[model samples]
Target chain A: MIIGGGSVGLMISYYLLKKGVKSIVIERKYPGSGNTYKCATGIRASFTSKEHIALMKRSIELWSELRDELGVFYERSGYLWLLSREEDLRTFKTYVSFQNELGIPTKIIDLSEVKCLAPTIVIKDLLAAVYDPLAGKASPFDLILQSWRLLVEKGCKVLAGVEAKKILLSKKGILGVETSAGFIESSTVVLATAYDTVKLLEPLNISVPIEPVPKHAFITEAYRDLFKPLIIDWTTSSYIVQTPHGNFLVGSEIPERPSDKLLNRLEFLRKASKVWTKYFPWMKEAYLLRYWTGYYDMTPDHHPIIGPLDDLEGLYIAAGFSGHGFMMSPSVGEVIADWIAEGRPRVPEALNLSMSRFKKGKLIKEIAVFG
Target chain B: MDSEKVIVCRCEDVLLSDVLRAIERGYRDLESIKRLLRVGMGSCQGRHCLPIIARVLAKTTGLRIDELNYPSSRPPLMPIQLKYFVSDGNEG
Candidate 1:
């Protein structure tokens, strides 16, 4: 059984089905109603760590294959990380070398080259940018919708509107889950329930080091495409990308608030607009369409908690993606399914993501996280 | 209503047929259909298309419109120009 029907859960279900393993996905709400739909939809493999780069590099390959199989457009428009500080440039120079060694084609481009790639950008204070041609965005809507359709067609069941209340345990290890509907008898269960994964595992005394850090994002009305690449200002953590549908998606980190209410603030609009206009003054002409808030399923180390729990024989976790869950879903699904089926993850790097890493203080210190 | 000619979401140019097709494809709820076909995501923000789609869904799925999960709505009921929100040297 897979709990949580977001991209991670759905992708896990998809791969499990592909392996000829019958699995049931239990969701409290409808699929894609969670963080999947709320994401900024940026996909990239460029990172500071070898583990993240390797995993996401594999994810990008899977995403390409999924495009043809699922009949959805995985837009490879690429990503450009704008570095304003010299230290950030130096840091990314080392990161690019590591990424290149790992077979990811990422390069540091100067201001003139950056301008050539994105003409609308104001080349004023920017030092340099790391460009990843392989990185881009995908439609979360179609991905989930298509996955659901295919899963059902393949005779796999996805029980929507049913909440997994608790994972039922026996002395032997796994009994199944006691849900809102009733009890499901499954020997193996994967918790992909984002921050809610903590609540379910709490009763079992499995302390998941995950926090739901809320963030805001908004999009403008369909406008003329000004830039192709998803451009991020490194210093400000501000990002803007024109979607394939022509809407300019703009998002930036918001200041910490006392309350974690999922509400859009007027201050977010002011701050994000300030960053956008600073880089591209033409963005001031754009009309605000919609603004919403979603939480990042953050872990202590910023890396996701994947792999099985040592205490529970049949329990596995694939949650705590920080903010990159949607982008990493493809590879995560493949890895988790392999771990479940074969009792080991196909990739060696996935072993580093187990929940026990927190107990051992072996946190994967990831620096490429968005605020 | 001729589903092809009948437009449900005017902002996104979604037809009644489009919504019907989404429903036929098993997107039973308003939220799923909204994301699948962009049914209610537009300048109007589902204010106009939601009721129509809900009625359509209710009629087709045999579930009450109230029973189906409605998509969440937020502020700025209408699309607002960004110039209107420009800071006037007050915000520090």
Candidate 2:
């Protein structure tokens, strides 16, 4: 049984169906109604860790094959991580070295190359950039629809609007899960509810160190053929990408606050507009279309926690993607399924994403590009 | 016409008076009013009521018609039944 029908849960359902394992996905709301649809959809393999690089590398390969294999639409428009300081440049160089060691085609480019890649960028304070040609973007909604169709065709059950109320566990282990509608008997239960995973696991007394942080993004009125690659300025904590519809999607981090209100904050809009106007003076005249918000299931180390719980049998977790879950879903789902079924994976370090790391006080910190 | 005004979004009730009240609250912006009253967040997603609400807000707030901002467009763009999505188009 899978709780939450976002990208991760949907991908997990798809892989399970492919492996001929019977599964049912229960979503409190409709599928893709969570953070999955609100994602910026940028895909990349540039990470300092070998595990992240390998997982993202596999994800990119699967994204490349998605159109041909799953009949989905994906565009490899490339990604550019812009740097504005010497320290950022050094970090990019180190990340590029690690990515290269993992057989990922990533390299540090000069300012001139950055201009050539994205002509709209103002390169006055820009120092260097990490370019990954294989990195790109995909449509989260389309991917979910296609995956749902495939799952239905393979005779899998997807229960929408059915909230999983509790995970029923016996001395033997997880016997089943109770939902708003009825109870589902399953030997294995995977929690992929993103920010809601904590509340969902509370009944089982499984505490995950994941907190939901609000992230906001806005779109501008479409400009024909302006920006080429998805631009990430590590210094400013901002990124922008031109959508297929011609509108530019812009996002940035904001100070954390506790609120259930999903509405866009006025302060965020003012700050985001200032950042955009300063970086790309051309957008000063462009009208801001609309703004939306989503929560990031953040972990202290900024990496996702996958695999089974040490205390409980037949209980699995796949949350804490921070902001990268949408892009990394395809590969994560497959790796997790392999680990669950075969007791190993094509990439071994993913199994090391155990819950015991937190207990052992072993935390791995990465260069948080978004934070 | 006053009695004909309907409260579409239950989370906010958002009667025509509430919209005018938002304008009196110094919210000359349509997006601001929508955010305050949730006028466009019902199951219809403002499909049937946006233009009327915009006109009312404009007339009541004494703002020019073109000065009002458009409400945010959510995806799925249409109101889809949850059962239709899950049950392969066999509506419940």
Candidate 3:
């Protein structure tokens, strides 16, 4: 049984069913009604860390394979990080070399190439950009729909609007989850509950240090595609992308308190617009169509916790993705299914993301997190 | 008015037939329907579309319209420009 019916949980069920392993997914709300829907929609393997680059590289491969199967319109439009500061240029130059060495075709493009890629962008004070042609954007809604449809066809049980209140455990081993409705009897339980994973496990004396941080994004009215790739102002950690649907989706990180509520702030709008308009002055005329918020299931080192709780015999976890869960779900689901069915995750790097690392002081930091 | 031609969400150009099709496709909730067909997500922000959609949902799902919780409304309850938030000497 899987607790939390977000993209991660649903994808896990998808792979598990493919592996001939039958599992049930119970969600407090509808699937993709959470962070999966509110994500920046950018997928990339451009990272400073070897662990992230490797996993995301594998994930991008899986995304391509699953695109047709899931029937999602995935546009490999690429990602361009606009560097306005000298330090950022030096940093990205090193990152580009590192990413290229890791088999990801990420390179530093000059200002002239940047203009060719993102024509309407204002490149004043811009040095260069780190471009990853393999990175792209796709509709999370379509992914959710397709996954849900596949699960239905597979005859897999997915109960929506049912909340998992507690992880019912016995001293011997696993007992199942005590949900809002009743007790579900299952020995092997996977907690993909995001930040709420902490809450459900607290009763069982298992502590996963995942914090729910509020993040926001907004989209503009549909228009002609002005840019081909998702552009990020690296200095401010703000990004803008003209989606295939022709809406320019924009988001940024700003100072705000972490709250469970999906609260919208005028401050976020002001800060995000200032940075977006500074880079794409043409966007000033674009009407901000819709704005919304969601939580980033953050961990200490900004990497996800994926693997088993050694203390419990049949318990597993795949949460604390920080902000990249949606993009990483495909590979994560496959490996996690392998772990449950075939004894361990196929990828050795995935073992590093287990909860035990927090206690072992083995933290792999991912520095390329965008707002 | 014919369900096929009646305009339900003018902001997104969604028709009454579109909402019915979504409901037929297993999107029984307002949020799911909105996401699937872009209903109640236009400049009016569902000010006009939601009530009608809710009633349609109620008629089909056999649940009262009030039983259907409206999707959350974010800031700029009405359509407002981004510049307005950053405008100098302007009190919001």
Candidate 4:
């Protein structure tokens, strides 16, 4: 049984179907229409940690093959970050070492190279950049719907608009989950509901160290040559990427505050305008097309908690992706599926993502989370 | 804050009638109710609807409004355009 019908749950259901395991996906609302719909679908593996880079590498592979395998729209326009400060460049060098050691193919390029890649972008304060030519974007709606279609075709059950109330457990180990519709008898339960997992499991004294933090993003009206690749100003924590339809998708990180308010801060737009103008003075005249807000399911250390918990048997969690869950959902789905079938995650480092990490004080740190 | 207004979720344009229907169907928690009717899951990030819906829910369920556990309000307290939907690959 899978709780939460977002991309992670749906992808797990699809993989479970492939493994000959029929699972029921319980979504509180229209499945895949929750936080997954609010995600900025960036598929990048240029992380500053070993495990993240490895996991995201696998996710990127799945993303590239989705065009033919799942028949969805995915583009590999690459992600470029402009590093301006000396200390930031130094930290980025270490990231290069870690990412390179993990086989992510991330390269540190100079200002001239950055200019050639995105000539419209101003690199006046550039120290260097970390470029992942493989990083790109996709449509969250398309990925979720296509995965749902595949799940339906495979005879897996998707019960949307149905909320799971609790996980009914027995002393012996596994029992079933109590959902809004009724009770589902299943030995295995995967919580892919992100921060919601905390509230659902809190009644049972199971503490999931995940919190919802507010984030914002807004785009400008379609402009010709708004930049081909995703250009990020690392100093200001702002980024701009042209969509497949020629519009400029822009956003920046606000300090993570423990609030669920989904209001777009006007200051975000104002600061974004200043930052964007500083980088690309030519875009100073660009008018806003639309603006939206969402939240990130942030963990203590920015690493997600995957695998089954020791406190409860047969209860698996694949949540706390921070804000980067969408890009890793494809790979995370397979990881959860493998764990359910084979009794372990496909990636060995996944052990660090378990709930025990918090207790053991073995937090896995990612240097480039908001990046 | 308008007691006479019947809005439940201004972000999605949900109404008090729809929320009343959801609570009538045995939905108790604010999280479940939000999922069912998107009450506080809108643009104002529940600043406008949170207290109102919680008050109505408290009256219906006999639980204190503060006693109810609700999901966090998401960001962008305002509405945005759909043109940006085509690509959000780097929202991280």
Best by TM-score: 1
State residue A9's C-alpha deviation in candidate 4, in Å. 1.2
In model 3, what is the error at residue A125, expressed in angstroms?
Answer: 1.8
Which residue pairs come into collision in candidate 1? none
Top model by DockQ, which number? Answer: 1
lDDT of 3 by residue, A218-310 (tens): 988788877888888888878888877788888888876555576787778999988987777766677887888889988999999998888
The order of the candidates by lDDT, greatest first, is 1, 3, 4, 2
Candidate lDDT values, in order:
0.87, 0.75, 0.84, 0.77
User: What is the per-residue lDDT of model 4 for residues A194-287, given as tens digits with 9 covering 90 to 100?
Assistant: 8889998898888889888887787665566655668788888888887665667778876657765776676677777667767777565565
DockQ of each: 0.68, 0.03, 0.54, 0.06
Q: Candidate 1 docking category?
A: medium
Model 2, range A1-371, lDDT digits (tens) per residue? 88888899988888776677868988886677788878998888877776678788889888877777776667878888888889888877877887788787888889899878877768887778888888888877567766766776678887766898889988889889889998889889999888788898877777888988888887665668776678877876888888765768888767766435566676666666666666677676665645678888888788888888888888888898988999999988887677667766666778667777899987777775473
Chain B TM-score, structure 2: 0.68
C-alpha TM-scores of all predictions = 0.97, 0.79, 0.95, 0.79
Model 2 residue B1 distance off true place after TM-score fit, in angstroms: 31
Off by over 4 Å in 2: A257-263, B1-92
Per-residue lDDT tens digits for candidate 3, residues B18-82, read: 98888787777787778778777777888899999999999999977655656877766666666
